[model samples]
Target: MTKDTIIQFHNVRFCYDEVCAINNVNFNILENSLTAIIGPNGGGKSTIFKILSGLLKPDDGHFSLRKGSTIGYVSQFTDFDLSFPITVLEMVLSGTICKKVKPFYRYKKSHRDKARNAIKRVGLEMYEDRGINQLSGGELKRAVIARALASDANIIVLDEPDSSLDVEAAADLYRILINLKSDKTILIASHHLDEVIDIADSVLYVKSTVTKFSSTEEVKEKLGGGIII
Candidate 1:
């Protein structure tokens, strides 16, 4: 119950049919810090994100967000149907719904302004008015990030944001994350341990369970000589 603790998982467990996706997971996420959850694919990373984002309910145990806390999540998926017409700005503006404004009401200027700021933060200001179909893979990833940012949530979750980007695009993504760490509390599930270790204040290495949770230095030492989930 520390003042800065924003999230906690108490003996959290999830089962898919008969297979255990997560077992006895327990951890606390502090406010205003970046946490990297690193593990192999199919190791339940997406399952955990789904649970946190309220897309799924764990079969057992509990995960709690501090009172009044709100979260914005962008998944690792980018399999968008490009032909589905939607502009980048419009997509980002969708995040404004989190504000709980009246339904069917036209978005105010403030909403558009905030969405634009988020677009600029992701370096997509020039493409704001363009159809999402026009964006490259990397650009699409950043656009999703902008959508999350526009939500104005105190906590943000990003799952494998660097999955298919080229080295330069991935580097740019990291830069935006670095700038964001100063304000928003961020949780990321990434396999790029070497790249994220430097920026992450803490790390959670999971393999159907939490294998390690500690400062970056300590976790690196614990994982020395090899990287495996």
Candidate 2:
């Protein structure tokens, strides 16, 4: 692999019990670039994130990352209760739960410091002590980003971050993403074309596979079909 490539998919293919998910998908993710994954429902967009995040293994092909690379997945914790009695700081700290631990195992003061710094980095310093249940949708997403930052991961993958937010909230999220683009390799699954067109350097339109991988400005012109989101 070249020094610029961070993740490579070699003839990647995936199948469900009987249906195909990804088909001969080949792509390369470079360092410090934002690649937006876009497609309709059940178009294997989530499957791509699952495979990249190690939540599921592809049936036929494989992916490889740069040595010592770490993926900070933000959307995998969706099953947890949003109303749970946890502060934003506590939730962010959980991102590195297994990173440093002793036999007794309580979150260290150092961990809290990292979480605090990450919260501030994401513009969530004011919400550090706020309850998760009381946060707005936009605020919660920023907190999740803080969690990813605290994980000390160079690659951050978020699945459908724009799913539930309003236009204003989505715009807020987009601003944070733009701020992070200078340093992190972000792979987010989103359908909002308005947001992705502005934020993504490259766009991966995956309809069961990679239909096109091109500059954001050329995607609409080259895709040969209408983009729903």
Candidate 3:
């Protein structure tokens, strides 16, 4: 791998229950670059994200990261039990805790401080003490992002970050993400065409049987009239 390459996937193939999710995918994500992955629903975008985050292993082929690379991931929103008692601060702190010790260990003060700064960076300072269940949809998303930031990772991956966010909220989130681009490589799987184009240094278009990687303008040209926002 070149010094610039932070992630490399060579002839990677992944399947789920005998169905192909990704096929012979070969790509590289450069260090400190912002890459956006876009595709139609059921196009295996999330599956690819899972692989990069180490949540799932590829069925065949090789995937490697630069030595000592650290990754942080924020998943798409899903239904959760509102009754589960956890504060936003506690949730963000959990990311730091997970990195330091096994799941059974208690959180440390340094973890709490890192979480607090992450919350502040996302402009959710006042909501730190609020119960996660009490947050608005946008606020909840911000909390999750804060948690990812607290991971102190060399790479950050986010799945469907714009879902359920209003225009202003989405813009705010994008600003925060842009600010983060200088510190680490960022890979986001999103269908928000306008947002992706605004921030992306590269774009990865995933299909059931093929994956294409290119710059935003190149992808737009390759897709022709299909590049609608």
| lDDT against true structure, model 2 | 0.84
Off by over 4 Å in 1: 98-103, 225-229
TM-scores of the candidates in the order shown: 0.93, 0.93, 0.92
Per residue, candidate 3 scores C-alpha lDDT tens digits across 1-229 of 9999999998888999988898888888899999988888888888888998998999899889999998888898774555789999988987786555566688788888999999998899999999998998778888898988898888989899888888888888888888888887999888787678668898888886445556667776776434642
Model 1: how far residue 63 lies from native, Å? 1.1
Model 2: number of backbone collisions: 1
- Candidate lDDT scores, in order, read 0.86, 0.84, 0.84
Total clashing pairs for each candidate: 0, 1, 0
Who wins the lDDT comparison? 1
| Candidate 2 TM-score to native | 0.93
lDDT of 1 at 125: 94
Ranking by lDDT: 1, 3, 2
Query: What stretches of model 3 exceed 4 Å from their correct place?
Result: 99-104, 224-229
